[model samples]
Target: MEIRLAGIKEFSVADGPGIRTVIFTQGCKNRCKGCHNISTWDLNGGYIQEINSLISYIDSICPNKKVTISGGEPLIQYNELKYLLKVLYKKNIIYAYIQATI
Candidate 1:
């Protein structure tokens, strides 16, 4: 499977506890006012990335750290997110996700 993402933050302390690799998935329906990542709201925006390659990249660069899947809206790509979560689970990597609610 493939994932569309606005970008990836290799290291972030504000996203969650400890340093984390933040996967900023593309697309969102919320369209919250003053949203900082408004550009990520387009479903067809951002570049496509292979899921396996993403996992490998994270494994190599973000080992022993939490992986935070933020967005645009991570849940918008739930299937791919689930797969990514499963892979992370097998690797014993901790993860968290954030979403906007209204």
Candidate 2:
């Protein structure tokens, strides 16, 4: 599946429990007050990426670390994200986190 993304941080310490690779997906329904990623709220604002390429990139950069899926509300693209999570699960990657509002 293809995933729309705002950006990807190869390394992050604040996203989750440990050092993690943060995947910032594009598109969010919420426009909460004090939102920091306002630019990512548009559904068509970010580049599309293939799920495999994303996983491969993560593997190449840093594997076995936590992977945080943030937004633009990561759940906005639920199907794609679900598939991505499934693949990650099948690969024995257990440390995945999703940051979403509601």
Candidate 3:
């Protein structure tokens, strides 16, 4: 499956405890006041990426690193996120959390 992403941070400490890789998914409905990632609001703006490639990049960095699936709103691609989580889980990758905006 493919994913739309605003960006990917291969290595991040601020995202979670221990080493972490953050996937910044694209698209969001809620445009809250003073949003830092205003560019992620557009559903068509970011580049399309394959899920496998993203996982490969994460794996190449380290084994079983903590991952945070953050976005303007990650559930925007609910099915894709579900698949991504499954794959990550199989590889012993813990999903640290979802950085949700309410």
TM-score of each: 0.92, 0.94, 0.91
- The list of candidate 3 runs beyond 4 A from truth reads none
lDDT of 1 at 42: 97
lDDT of 1: 0.86
What digit string (tens of lDDT, one per residue) describes model 3 on residues 65-102?
78998987899999999998899889888865789876
Give the clashing residue pairs of candidate 1, or none: none
lDDT by residue for model 2 over 1-102, one digit each (tens)? 899999999779888887789999999889999999999999999999999988878777766556888999888888999999988788766778998888
What is the TM-score of candidate 3? 0.91
Clash pairs (backbone) in predicted model 3: none
Residue pairs that clash (backbone atoms under 3 angstroms), model 2: none
lDDT of 1 at 81: 90
C-alpha lDDT (0 to 100) for residue 83 of candidate 3: 90
After superposition, the stretches of candidate 2 with alpha carbons farther than 4 Å from their true spots are none
How far out, in Å, is residue 45 in model 2?
0.5
* Poorest 10 consecutive residues by lDDT, candidate 3: 57-66
Rank the models by TM-score, top first.
Answer: 2, 1, 3
Order of all candidates by lDDT, from best down to worst?
A: 2, 3, 1
